[model samples]
Each structure stands twice: as structure tokens, then as C-alpha cells.
Target: MPHPSCARRWAMPKKAKQADLKKLAICVGLGAAIWAIPAPAGVGLPAWRLLGIFLGTIAGIITQPLPLGAVAMMGLGAAQLTGILTFQAAFSAFANEIPWLIAIAFWLSGGFIRSGLGARIAYSIVSVFGKTTLGLTYSLTLAEALLAPAIPSVAARAGGLFLPLAKALCLACGSDPANGTEGKMGSYLMMTCFLSTTISSAMFITAMAANPLAVNLAAETLGYTISWGTWALSALAPGLVCLLLTPALMYVLYPPQVKDTPDAPAKAKEELKRLGPMSRDEKITAFALGLTVCLWIGGQSLGINAVAAALAGLSILLVTNVVTWEQCLSDNQAWDTLTWFAALIAMAAYLNKYGFISWFSDKVVGMVGGLGLSWQAAFGVVTALYFYSHYFFASGAAHIGAMYTAFVSVSIACGTPGIVAALALGQLSNVMGCLTTYGIGSAPPYYGTGYVPQAKWYQFGFIFSVIYLVVWVGVGSAWWKVLGLY
Candidate 1:
């Protein structure tokens, strides 16, 4: 017989594997069953079939049946084999500029991590503004805002850059996530960083991958062109308000025991000294990052595409050896995100191509029309429903692709102004992401840091969602009136 310890260890993995297989089987079986059920006479086979696959995939993601990329691919493959989607259509998402932009941004972030440039910036800020716990939180918020305009992947920004620094800072302060000492300062910092990045992601068109995707959908659905400046201008007031208020609010709501951090600035300085001067790799990463930011900001005037600009920046990272080819290829998160995002983009595009979105929008318009409410009142109800629905989504891009067009169409049919409805829904795409940890790319990593418990995360998410809705929608509507958007 095997030794008892070895037997227990081996059995544990086997049991877990069995559980995973069972979940996968359940997901696949449910999808097939759904597909087998005939749709109502008016609904097209393609639309109904696609819905089945999409639901199954989402369930699989939530249920942990398989890796997200694997589940996404399985959905695509099922659609192709069932004749719901053509082979060419299934592969088209890989060609999408938005997903590739995200991938390139991920690669660039690797350069920042490997070269220590991201850490250097974080420490520098903390040293300057670490006199109090609230000051440190503000520094993190400021850092995230400064970097938001240039970095399209909030995962890379929050997960890759800010997370490491936040962890290090927590450790330096003698607060550990794993040892139940998180309430000292780690939880507060983690929550502050998470919320700050979420708000910052709305401040610029290029701040997060989902922003560009939202812009594309708006242009396609409404024939409204939203420039980078236009997106930034619209979000400036509301985004800054949320960003400024978040840290202070967290300070009041979840005050850390370690309110005094006077030694933190000195500690940061000492830590910087220990690391000595910046290296060649750091310099290269810094130069590439700066050049890329300038290019992205001015790309419209230069007639350069954002995706192409990111690719160019990636090439610079490669040539300078700030990040090795092996490192880039080995980044599982980047590749995994690319696969799932591409597959989702393809599926969403086909939904629009096949008239599903139009049908859905028509139904919604009918429902709202029957209510006899005025346009503003109707829009308020529609916006509330749309914003809260984010709790079901794991990706902001997916939410925007699925619901944004339909909601905007309904709002317009209800007599709301086109520009007002378009921009409101567009900005809320990022704002709703605050509703849950899985609501956006950056949320998962921040949650995975182990500082905040899941229940508290959810509780706090609800609290803050109400706060942001008031600020962004209430205050934002008034600001839009001033800008003559209505």
C-alpha cells in the first residue's frame, strides 16, 4: 500500500480534477440542451443558437469548469461546428485591432515590470507623499491617473505595475495579507488602488481596452464619431470627482488602524537607495513608455492608428531588450486574455451582423414605449437597469458589446437625445465596472491580492456603485447640460 501522506496528497488532486471534469460536462451538456430547444417562431436559429453558446460560456467562466480561454474557445468551436458561425467568421476576431492593442499593451507592461521602472515610479511617489496613510492612498491614485491615458490594459497597469508596488509597501509596513494583519493598512491601500484604477480607466479613450471597444460600438450603432479628446473631455469632470473622492471615502468607511505613516516616506527613500541608480533596462523602458504615450495622445493628428502605435511601442521594447522575446511569449495572462477577448469580439460582431441586436433593441423599445413615461424618466430607468446588470458580467468589453447598442437604441427610441444617450452609456461602461471584482480586467488581480475578503468586496462594491452612480450620472448629467450635449 502507498504511504498515508502520499496517498492523501495524490487523492486531493484527483478529487479536484474530477470536480473540474464534472463541471465541464455539466456546462457542455447544458449548452447542448439549450441549443436543442427550438426558439419561438420569430427568432432566427442563428440568434437563438448563439445565445445558448454565450450563456454556456458565461456559466463556465463563473463555475470554474475550465480555464477561461479554454471555455471561450470551446464556445467558438461549438458555434462553428453547428453552422451558427462560419469558419472565417470565427477566426475574424483575431484580426480585431482592440484585442491586439490589449496584447501589445500587456507586452509593454512586461518591460516595465522587468526593468523596475514601474516600481521606481511608485516608490518615488510614496516617498514624496507618504506622511500619512491618506497621503499614500492619494499618491497611488495620482500615479494611476497619470498612467491611465497611455496604458490601454488596466490589468497591466494595476495588476502588473501597481500591484507589485502595493504589495511591497504593505510588506514594508509590517502588514501582511496572508497573516490576518491586512486591516492595519493593506486592505485600505488595496481597496484604494482598485477603485482608483477603475475610475482612471474612464478618464481617457485609451485608458482601458474596453473604452476603445465602446467607442467602436457607438460609432457603428449610432453613426457618432467620438474622438479621443471628446471621450477625455466628457469623462474629465466625473472621472476626476470619483477619483478624488474614492480614497477619502475609503478612509472614512474602512479606516485602517495604521493612520500614521510618517516613517513611510523615509522608508521609501531608503529602499530606493538600496536599489541604487536606474539601470540601462530602466532607461530604455522609460523612453519607450514616454514615446508611446506621446504617440497615443497625438496619434489622431499624425494619422496613426492606436493599435499601430502600440505595436510600434512593443517593437521598441523588443529591440531594446527591456523585455525578452521569451518573456513576452511566456506571459500566460496576456495570451490567455488575447484568446478569450478575440473569441468574444468575434461572437459579438456576428450577433450584430445577424440582426440579433436590432431585434433585441426593438423589443426593448416596445417595452419602454408602453410605459408612457417621459424621455428623461424612461432613460433614467433604462440607465439604472443597464448599470446594475454589470453584476452578471465578467468583462467590461463583453458587457458593452452585448448591451450597449441595445440600450442606447432604446434610449433614443424613447426620445432621448442621441449624443446624450450615446455618451452617457459610453461613460457608464467603465463606471459600472466598479460593481464587482470580475467586472473589469483589473479587478481580478486586485481581488486576488488576498487583502480583502470576498464578502466585504461585494459589500463594498455595492456601496461604492451607489456613490459613483450619484456622482457620474447625477453630476454628469448637469455637466453635460452645460456643455450643450443635450
Candidate 2:
């Protein structure tokens, strides 16, 4: 007979399989229920059917009955097999530039980790400003902000890069979660770093994978084109303010027992000394990153597409062997993102193409118009609803794919300025991740550290969600006014 522990391990997979099957049943049931509804007067049957598939796919993504890519493939197949879309129409978005841009950027982002540049930068900042607990948290925040544009994956940036660093700092300070000493410094740092990732994600177009999806949706839905420079400039002031305030705010809300960490700087320096001089790969990665960023910011004026710029950057990395071709092929995240992103984009575009979005916008406008509120107030209501709805979403990409275009459409239909509506909703697509531990990609690792209890995590998440909205909407609007974005 097997040992008890071995038997328990064998039983675990069966239990997980049952759970997944239940979730999958929910997704299929939801889709079937929606499909049973008659198509609205102005919408085609195909459009309504695609909506069912799209929504079911979103539910699958959130609940994760299968891998994200598998969920997406199933949704796409459902649409095609049900005669809701042709094979060509189902896969056409794969040809779009947005998905390719994100995929290529993901490959480029890997160089930061592979070259040890990401760690080097984090340690260097810690060595400079890590004398106190607050300062140490700020250093991590700064590192995240600096790295966000280059590293598109928040999981990689936060979990792979900063999570380990934060844990190390905590260990160095004798604050192990295992020892009930997480309050010494671990909890505060973990919360701050996790929140900071969301803020930095809002700052740049390339900072998060879903950001480009939002950009694409805005262009398709609102006919508003937000360039890389526009996104960066619009977010610069508000993003910085959020980053600056987050560490301090967390320090106040979740004070560390260890207020002074005098040894942190020494530890960081020792880490730096161990890393020694920058390797050739690091220099190449740095050069490629700098060039890509400059091009992204100003390449439009030079008549270069942002996707072209990213492709160029990835080419440089491959040529220099900063990241090998084999490594790029092995980048499961990039390929997975490409697959799901393309499918969702195709589905969303077809929704608009078939006139469902316009029909839905009309229905929304009629309801909101009945309230006799001013356009500004209507938009505020819409924006608030959009931001808070993130609580129901696990992946930022799923949230963006499912709701961004519709919300932007409703906002514009309510007479909000198109650019203002698009940018506001776009920025919130990222910042909304601050509302829950499972709100986005980077949340799990930080929360899994056991530093902050689930209750405290949710509590701080709510507090910061409000704080983020005020900063991004209030301060961000003022900055946008100066830039004439409105």
C-alpha cells in the first residue's frame, strides 16, 4: 500500500480535476443561457451568439477551468463551429499589429532577467536608499517604476524580480513570515511593491500587456489613436505621484516593526559586489531597451510604427545573442498572450463590426439619459462602475477584452470628450488591479508570501483603490489639461 502522504498527493489531482470540471460547467451553462435569448432588434443573431461565446470565454479566463490560451481557443472554436464567424473572420486579428507588438515586447523583456540587469538595478537602488524601512520600500518602488516600461510582465517584474528581493531584505532584517515576524518589515514591503507594480503599469504603454489591448480597442471603438508618447506623457505626472505616495501611504497604514534597516544598504552592496561588472549581454540589453523606448516615444514623428520599433529592439537582442532564438521560442507567456489576445481582439472587433456595440451604447445612453444628469456626472458614474468592476476579474487582459470598449463607448455616448474618455478608461484598466489580491498577474506571489493576511490584503486593496482613483482621475486630469489631451 502507498504511504498516507503519497496517497494524499495522488488524491489532490483528482480533487483539482473535479473543481475544474465544475467551473467549466458553469462557463458552458452561462453561454448556453445567453444563446437561448433572442437577438435584440438591431443586433444580428451571429453578433448575439458571439457575445455568448465571448462572455463564456471571459468567465473561463477568470475562473481558469483551463489555461488561458486553451480557454481562448475554445471560445474561438465555439464561435466558428456555431457558424457565428467564418474561419477567416475568426482568426483575422492574428494579423493585427497589437498582439504581435505585445508578443515581441515580451521576448525583449526576458533580456532584463537573463542579463541580470533587472536584479542589478534593484540592488543598486537598495544600496543607495535602504538605510530605513520606508526608504527601502521606496527603493523597490523606484526600481519598479524604472523597469516597468522595459518589463511588460508584472509577474516577472514583481514576482521574479522584486518578490525575491523583498523576501531577502526581510530575511536580512530577521523578519520571516514563518516566524510570525512578518510585521517587522515583510508585510509592508510586500504590499507596497505589489501596489507599485499596478501604478507603474499605468505609466507606459509598453509597461503592461493589456495596455496595448486597451489602445487597440480605443482606436477601434472611439476612433481615438493614443500614441506611445501620448500615453506616457498623459500618465507621467499622475503615475509618479502615485508611486511616490504609495510607499509612504503603506508605511502609515501598515507600519513596520523594524523602522530602521541600517544593514539593508550593506546587504545590497554585497549583492552588487557579487554581481561585479556589467556583462556584455547587459550592455546590449540596456542599449536595446533605451533605443526601443526612445523610438516608442518619438517614432511616430519619424513615421515609424510602434510595433516596428519593438520588432527592431527584439531583432537587436537576437543579433547580439542577448536573448537567443531558442529562448524566444520557449517564451510560453508571449505565445500564449498572442493566441488569447488575438482571439479576444477578433471577437471584440466583430462585435463592433456587427453593430452590437452601437446597439448596446444606445441602450445605455437611453437609461443614463433618463436620469437627467449632466455629461460630466454621467461619465463619473460610468468610470466609477468600470474601476470597481475589476473586483470580478482576475486577469487584466480579460477585463480589458471584455469591458473596455463597451465602457469607452458608453462614456463617449454620454458626451464625454472622446480622448478624455478613452485615456481615462485606458489608465484605469491598469490601476484597477490595486483593488484585490487576485486582481492581476502580480498579486498571487506577493499575497502567497503570507506576510499580509487575506483580510488585510483586501482592506488595503480597497483603501488604495480609492486613493489610486483620486490620484489618477484628479491629478491626471489636471496634467492632461496642461498637455491639451482633453
Candidate 3:
């Protein structure tokens, strides 16, 4: 590893660094040129100016012209320099509870990873369920669901735990990627690993970094507040069905060549023995996580916000030394997410404040109205299109930033109930990740194993995306209806 002092200098080859700078300059130059065009009829100059910065920021994110946060910071700075937003307004993004909740959850999960609690839990489940090829698939899925709530970073949970275990399981079964034997069982498990995490991410507001961002956006758009309990309760029925059926569906769709793995349980047990007993730090992390869940679920009645519960839990971990201060600070992903999320949140807020979102919504609603479809039909078409549009996006949060508000606004204007519209759109923001190998946080790690080729991954992605949408849309719609969300 390079020294800390020179880490950024040596982070990439010089050629790649220059290429990224070129991409950044092109995005900014094009965005500024676009902003120079005169606004039509009623759109104000500030809204148009802010829109320019927003477009440029999104370009940087998609092209990865810089680290995501750095790109976002440049947008924030641009907004201030152009006088589109005051200093207080731009910095106000950090004051929002949504980003803080996400950041703190990341810190709390660091304790689980650092203390080895998450790995212990995964191995424990594996020992029970690894007796059969089918059982081992379910074991990995269940392990991810258990960890998703506390661990906001799905990439860490899936990559850190599922990736290594999956490789081991596949190799143990003689399904080596290098030998072209991934068709045996490796492909099935790897596909299930990613699909399961996507479902779990939709099931809880704290399950992924983008979920809380969805909640905040829903609030900004429709005055809806999605708490941890509300998000879980809404997703409980369909989410459980999707989780239960995904492994079986993949088993049939992508059948494993090696089926009779009767010795797998013994292998898992042996691995567990090697890990030994859970350490004190592991115990403490588990306890803190459990407590945090309880507080997140119940604290609303006691006048506590979920953000506070997360902070309180993180404090316990810090004080108990379950995770060191340096470990928490060194969580670069969490901090990076915080910066970009804040910047996006600020832009979203200013867009609403400047009437850009509302103005754009009215114009879109008028065109949809011109189609002469009933409100129900219009919304159904829009929602389907929005969910499948993930094929064009590589990040869930960025997709949310670009399309969520306008879609929700259109849905509401088309006479869809606010609560129903908000929850469905919010949930789909995560479920849509099933459409691509690079669509969400956990996608790359699972895809990087090379067990599933690009063509096969996309094929499976389309097939599974349909299954997930049916469960989430059909079954989920019924569940929400029963809850009177509509």
C-alpha cells in the first residue's frame, strides 16, 4: 500500500487521472452552455441556473469524473457562486436528519464488521442450512436480511460476508469460475446473493443508504413521513414472499448441476469451530444493534427520532470500545455518502423552494392528461416505466435524485392518493436495482466474481426484475391497500 501521505497521489494511474479530469471539464462546460439558454415563459433564472448545476452534478456522478462526494461538492459550490442559493441554504443540507441517519447507521454497522459479529452470524446460519444446495442459498439470503437493517451499506454486507462465503461454497462444490464450472452451483448462489439483498433493501428504510433518502424526498414531495416501522410494515407481506420464493425461483430457472451436497453442513460446522466463540466486542455489538432496532421501532412514541436512536447506539459502541474511534472515522464510504447525499438533498430542497419541481410537475401532468387516460392507468404506466428505467442508471440514489420527485408529483396530480403514491414510488426506488448488474451497491461485488457472464447476468436480471416487480407491485399493492395506505 502507498503511504497515507501519498495515497491520493498514487490512487490511480496518471493516464486514468487525466481522462477523469477531461470528463469533468466536458460535463461542466456543457452544463454551463446549456444554462446560458434563455428560460421560457414562467421559469425563473434561479431555477434554471440550479437545474444547470444539478445536471452537471449528475453527469459527474454517472461518469465518475471524481469521487462522488467531490463532484457533489463542486455542484454545491457552483450553486453558491452563481447566487442561486445562499450559504446557509446550501449548508443546510447537512442539517437534515435523513443524511445523518444514513451516516450514523453506517457507523453502527462498522461495529458489527469490526467486532466480527456479522460474520459469526452468517457462519452460524450456514452451519444449519448448508446441508443442501437449496438450503445454502436460503442461508445466505437470511443472513443478509438479518444484517441489512443495522448495516446501511449493502455493498459492505454483501461483499464483506456473502462474497467470500459464496466463493468458498462454490469452490467446495467444484464449481470454479476459472474452470468454467460456475454453471454447477456458483451462478445460482451468486445471483441469489444479489437479488436477495435488493429485496431486503426495499423492505426497510434503514436497510440501504438510499432508502432514507427516499423517505426524505417523499416528505418533500407529498408531505409523507416514512419511519422504520412504517417502511417495514408496508413491505412485510410482499417482501417476505419475494425473499422466500427467490431462491426456489432461481433454483428452477438456473438449476445447479451439483444438487446433492449432503456434506456441506459438516463443512460449515467445521468453519464455525475455527471461528471460536463470539468475543466480548461481538456480544456488545450485537446487544447495541438489538437495542438500536428496538429504539428505532418504538422511540417514535417516546418522542425520539430514528436518527437519535442511531446516534445513541453508535455512542454505546464507541464507549464500550466495540469499534474504535478511528474505525468509525475511517468509514470513508459513509462519509462520502453523507457529503453527496447532503449536496443532492440541498439541490432537491432548493428545486422545491424555487418552484422548479412544481412547475415541471404541472407541465408533465398536463401532457399526461392530454393522453386522456384515467388517473389509475396513467400512474400505472408511469410507475412501470420508472421502475424499469434503472437500466439507464448505475446508482439507486442518483436515479432517485433525477426522477423520483417528478414521478411522485405526476402520480399525485393524476389523482393517485399521496400516501400510496409515496410509498410505492419510494419502495420501487430500491426494487428497480434488480434491472442491472451495476445498478446498486451490492451489484459489482456479486458480478465481479465472474461466475455469471455479462450476457447471462443481464438475462437473469430482466427475468428476475419481472418477478420482483410482480411481487412488489401486485402483492405489495394489496398489502398497502389492506394497511389503508391508499
Number of the top TM-score candidate: 1
lDDT (Cα atoms) of all candidates against the true structure: 0.74, 0.76, 0.73
Winning model by lDDT = 2
Per-model TM values vs. the true structure = 0.76, 0.66, 0.66
Clash pairs (backbone) in predicted model 2: none
Report the poorest 10 consecutive residues by lDDT, candidate 1. Answer: 1-10
Tens-digit lDDT string for candidate 2 (31-80): 99999999989898888988888889877766768766788899999998
| lDDT for residue 253 in candidate 1, whole number 0-100 | 92
State, as a TM-score between 0 and 1, how close model 1 is to the true structure. 0.76
1-486: candidate 3 lDDT, tens digit per residue: 101211111122222233387889988986797699987667888988887888788677657678767888998999899899898988887986656665665666556555666555645555677667898888778878987886665665565445655655565456766567888888998998888989888888878778788889889987657778888999899889989999998999888887766776686677667768877887887788777767665676788766777777788898997766776666565677778767776776677677665676556666775776887788777788778766545467767776787888888877888777778888878878777655776776566556877667778888987888788778988898899887
What lDDT score is found at residue 81 in candidate 3? 91
Candidate 1 lDDT, tens digit per residue, 154-178? Answer: 7656764577567656655666654
In what order do the candidates fall by lDDT, top score first?
Answer: 2, 1, 3
Model 3 deviation from the true structure expressed as Cα RMSD, one decimal place: 7.5
- CA lDDT, candidate 2, residue 413: 72
| Model 1 accuracy (lDDT, Cα) | 0.74
Q: In terms of lDDT, which candidate is stronger, 2 or 3?
A: 2
lDDT of 1 at 247: 92
Model 3: weakest 10-residue lDDT segment is 1-10
